[model samples]
Target: MTDYDVIIVGAGGAGLAAASAASENGASVLIVEAAARAGGSTALSGGVFYAAGTSLQREAGIEGDAPDAVFQYYMTLNQYKLEASLVRKLCDDSPAAFEWLRSIGVEFRAEDLYMSGVDKVRRGHRAAGGGAAIAEALEGSFAGRSVDVALETRVETLLIEEGRICGVIVDGQPVRSSATIITTGGFGANPAMLAQLYPDAAIHGDQHWYIGAPTCRGDGILMAQAAGGQISAANRGLLLLTPGFAKELESYVPGWLMMVNREGRRFVDESIEYSVMAAVLGEQEDRIAFGIFDEASRMASKTTSYRPAPNWTADRLDEFVAAGTLEKADSIAGLAERIGISPDVLHTTVNRYNDHVSDKADGGFFKPASFLRPITSPPFYAARICAAIICWTGTGLRIDTRAQVLDAADRPIPGLYAAGETTGGMFGECYASGGASIGNAIIFGLTAGREAAALARLHAPLAATS
Candidate 1:
């Protein structure tokens, strides 16, 4: 059995950040990761941090906004669905979190990316090389430290002593520690959990691909529950429906088109908030929509401004169409016929949208005209954009401002702490602007490490156990 001051699970952005901080604070730390690589979903992310009114913003000549305003924005957007305490902490600590990353040698460029769907102020900080670069920087900081990283190791269960979490069981061996942090990411990739939590969505055969790591299997949630922690309301978890073919899998393949409903009618405006599209898709009985576009729309997708990924191109679109994965037609009526919808209904919907776009008014659907390009060009194209889900669960553990995990009774689980996606109840119900996950992970991970080290120094020698 290996003994340490602290044992951190999931070596993603949060775990790495915690290890670095704890080691700097003079505590022996052990980081165990299931994957061979260090970075979890953070490495696969776009590397944007959604922080407001930070020194980075001021340095970049951006204005300093109030944390209260950020909190209010969150409340308004989420319709007061999130917990007030957690939301307040996220907003209050966000600026400091941004600065902490900079102090650790992770550089942030001044360019700000905006999510127009949220329609809020632009406050996203992009890291160089995206998520991978941030991970590399953190990994570099851990060189030659007392912090030991064990990769390809899975933590099987929490070792409890007298009703308190004392350590964890890894690979069938008991590794003891004063504390354990559960930063195991979200349960978006867990199909079983998804089926249980979202029965309505499961019936439609909805699936998810983007927004979470494949290893995020609700391990932390399950372990905590088994150890007597209670689960929160499972009412949250959003869907990501992209324009593609096949039920719930079209987002993976190529198809540049607009999204529509089962009536072969274009419903919500395509170019708006992803949350809105997700909400709309979740309500649909079919849970499968069509992406109606033309050759010109496909060609436009190749431009840097519109292209989300390099692989999304007209060539890929043609290949999918040739493969019978996409339905191509010379007219809207023809496209509707192929998709087994009434051509008159599809035609009327498109005609109404064209008039709205031409008149610069979205009377039927309030989506901005900037996102409302007429779908009149030919040869018309349509693909099934399956409703995919990306659920966020098992976030910031019930720790204090210092990021330590709290026990079932709301007391600190000594020496143990968590950060990032593993820290449950941090973001509450609303996922604020982009970068909330990474930013919170970095901030709280550092806090947990520093606090745990300080606490370890003051504590008496560990009690002997079998």
Candidate 2:
């Protein structure tokens, strides 16, 4: 006997959304998660939704910003790499998705915020409680609903019948279903998968670290591949600049700090987005960079992005200094010597930068005058900044706009669907924004669930006869 009409794998944002949609469509649903809890990397996120045409948008008093504009913005960012149909689905349906979440107990505020890669619209709607709140709302949505969820149940393999995905095997037991959906998230926690998929990142040896949920080990991707689903851009991920040892620093690097490669020279505008920063760091020697700042810069600047590190009090900065993560020196030469770079080159770099700051101009990188603070204060600092994985893996099975898992030939494998990070082709070489990732997860997760449930209903008679 079939276990359910729809069997959704992984209980993250995508899986929960899928399960809820399936249940609403009159299909019996069961969500099997490998982790002990429902929230995957979604719980670790900022819980912002990139949506257009929302009531919040109207309330914010921004006029003439339509969904089409949002769609155009993403198209420009992705450079037509992502499927236009899927992108349209996300952009057009996002407002309804945001409202649906509200209908399901998810709370969001109408705050106009501009995120990285989003140039025109301020559509980032922040969840009232961040990622955890969104996760809690989705998890709570399943209560009293016609859905069964299994936590800590590792799906070992897909149960294929004559090349069609019918269900999954977990702990040597098979639970047959009319339709199966994969929402297992990305592979940030799996070092082996990381080395295999992103070998370039592996070149860092011991320096690379992932800052996502440990449960995100790419189980759905592996199972999808084993079941003959085609993989898309498995090598790409959302990488951030950080002082590797301290995971908390992943959010915001002070703009006043100059980021230098191993050769001891600034490579990019210190005020650039994290995705652009990561790409620049990848080209540097050893894939490593350092955030160079002085006492004045530190005292004057506040954390601009990541909330956890926005206000670095003296005590917190001192703690990092005492821990040696943030190196200190009385002179530019001393700072260079501490970080093992050429003192003369470091001095020249500082001198040139100080000259630019004095002129209120960034000749090379064009950083705005507001962020160009001179690094002349005594006791300069250079903190090692490396790329940290933020769990938005640019990888996994190929899916069409309907969220059907496609084979090598781009043909949909019947009864199989995918959503969230497990389904690739949305993100390419760069992460658009935090809101984009989470919003796509919810939109596609809902699509996959409804489509899979419809498929289950269409095949129920055939399944019963068989």
| lDDT string, candidate 2, 1-466, tens digits | 6879999999889988898888888999989988888888888887888887887778878777777987777677767777778778888999899989999888766553555353646777888888888989888876787798899888999999998899999899899999999999988778788788866556666766666677788889999998899998656767777675455535557676777887888888887766456766777887788888888876765544444454354466767888877899999888999999999888888889999999999997898788798888888988887776454677778899999999999999988999998877777666666588888889999999999999998888887887
What TM-score quantifies how close candidate 1 is to the native fold?
0.87
The count of residue-pair clashes in candidate 2 stands at: 0
- C-alpha RMSD of each candidate structure in angstroms: 3.6, 2.5
Among the numbered candidates, top lDDT falls to: 2
Alpha-carbon TM-score of each model against the true structure: 0.87, 0.92
| Poorly placed runs, candidate 1 (over 4 Å) | 112-117, 198-207, 245-258, 303-312, 360-363, 366-370, 389-416, 426-430, 461-466
lDDT of 1: 0.69
Quote the positional error of residue 37 for candidate 1 in Å. Answer: 1.9
> Which 10 residues in a row give candidate 2 its minimum summed lDDT?
302-311
